[model samples]
Target: VSSIIVPITNVMNDQYCYQTSKKIRQVFDYKRRNGQYIGSNPPFGYVKDAKDRHHLVIDPDAAEIVRLIFSLLLKGTSKRGISFYLNEHGIPSPSVYKLEKGMTVSNKPDGNTLWSGRMIHTILTNPMYTGDLVQGRFRVKSYKVHQIETVPEEEWVRVADTHEAIIDKATFEKVQELLLRDTRTSPQGRTVHLFSGFLKCADCGRAVTRCSGKNNVYYACATYKSRSRNACTMHSISHARLEAAVLYAIRQQVHLAVSYSEVIAQINSAPIKKNQSFRLDDTIHAKERELAKVTRYKQSLYQDWKDGEITQQEYRDMKATYDRQINEVSDVLARLTAERAELANGVDKEHPALVAFKKYQNIDALSRELLIELVDHIKVYENGNISVKFKFADQLRRIAEYIDVNTAESPAWAV
Candidate 1:
């Protein structure tokens, strides 16, 4: 009776195993048909079958559409804007094209009929747009689940010029640059403003959003706009007013910057200690010595590990401690080097900030280009007191301090 029961259990096991194997094959077949196997892989045209993997060909029309999409995105059109542009013009999306031909497609979001930001961003970042075919960017964990992990970019299988590029290299690079620039902001915490992310609201710690009425541009508190009167009041300011204040402040700073150069020149021409050059060198050398000492200490911890004087865990912890000390020393050395270089280069005479500011020295008014170049941010406070911050203000302030310390007499040009 025991042997009969064992045979029955063995029969049950065999049936389960067969069913599991069959299901596994079905899943693999589904994946192969739907392109999920190469979903995260680089676009290398359509793959017809397993045997014909290398025989894939480029779809010229799809390549042309990709180029057009890249152009629209680079022109400051948002992803939604691009999708609308495409759909309104009766261009079929990738999903739509597949569906029309009765091809099975997966991974589409429910209830979405067309293109989306994720799709556009994917296309924008796709190296295929630049005529490079990428493959093996992700992988499934197991046969039971569809979860996938992304492969590192460096490890991705890349084939260059596998298809005609939709966008040129230079244009693609320009789009990338534009994308890298900080642009969008969520102010009011609900609606996004083009300029909302660009400006900061001083009172409520929210971004100021742009609003237009009767041909006038005004910025208001984003929190107040979304949450209501309970949150915050609308710290409203007109665009024209903001623009005027910013331009005026920039011009004033430029004037100050130009004057600073003259003051530095005056101070440099004055009689000072001729031996000060050696002092600067001594300061730099001392920093370098400190850096070397920390590096040597860090190396000794590794030596302890090699000599079997420390456990693996203890060695790791001690090495980390020494590494942190080394980093701190390195940071100090870098600062000292920069300061020494500044002193040697007659920093007051040839600072990049000073040079850039001097270019507009004779200009009467500020231009858009000038504003972007010099200004970091302009925060409008609750009390209507605007604090204008210039780029590299710390360096400028340092120069001012140096002038105060070194100059025997105050120059007329010193602001």
Candidate 2:
């Protein structure tokens, strides 16, 4: 009798465990869908709301630091340089700041409050700073197994506008773009020198870095620096010479853009008329129509299956195919529509990037904004042959093609 009672009791306990697990999972899923901040602590730029633990509000001091980091980045300061500035000013890193506020962190950095490039980079890249709530990045394997595993990025739960933003979306995007470029810092002045990441090895197509020279600074092939010259050429360009070359190239383009009617004509014509501009609109419309047709077919699939026209498995398979095609067409249609809208709106006078060269017409100096916007890249050959590829080169060529076909009034540019 005792053995029978014990077995029954074990069965009852297992049933209770199963039900409890299901209920807990349901609660977690509901919270995730509602865009709550589930983490124990808010991100660096924010503090969790006292009454509503799931909501976040800007931490004024941390928010200011975030803005300064972005501002310095736009001004061409590299991540290391920014980190140095923060450390030198005795500003606390996020972990340190939390600790000072009497909050306990489980995995704080081993080091002190000294800032590092990695810390700055993490904040710069985080979408949370843009007011997007991204959760479920890691999860327990199951109820029985408590091991944590990283969820793939595609599977992470994301909801936008969950809180006030510390950084504007445009600035965040621009900072991301800048981070991808060749920006590096000098240990000398805790500053990022001009043309830090701009130069590249013309031969191997690798990035060039600055290194010690006899009595001056010189740019050398990064590959050579790592290995030896046997791997790549010096591909050397001095700081003074490289700066001058870049400046001269920019000044030349600015002169042409401002003084040359041809440049103005190209800038105007490039957006107004693309040979494929009409094609983009036509393709989008076609895809949108396809999506509608697929949707209509999907609606009929259930009825067809109900009337015994197709097997259950076949009905499901065909329905899935139609749904997938519909999604694909919708995505393509959206992208093409955005492209068409952007080109159409480029003619607006208030658009800052539209014919940006015009703003620098009376230019006396070059800014990071101008450098990034106008120059795609500069290639330095071993023989000191510097090539500056203007961002608008392809557009200028297309404009020339347009003018050639439409009328003979267009002036041809001489190399």
lDDT score for candidate 2 against the true structure: 0.76
Tens digits of per-residue lDDT, candidate 2, 167-195, equal 98877877777778867566664556667
Model 2: pairs clashing at backbone N, Cα or C within 3 Å: 182-197
Q: Write the per-residue lDDT of candidate 1 for residues 296-390, one digit (tens) a residue.
A: 87778778888998888998887788788778878877776676566555554778778877787676654434544566656766555566778
Tell me the alpha-carbon RMSD of every candidate: 10.8, 8.9
Task: Report model 1's TM-score to 2 decimal places.
Answer: 0.48
Assess every candidate by TM-score: 0.48, 0.65
lDDT of each: 0.65, 0.76
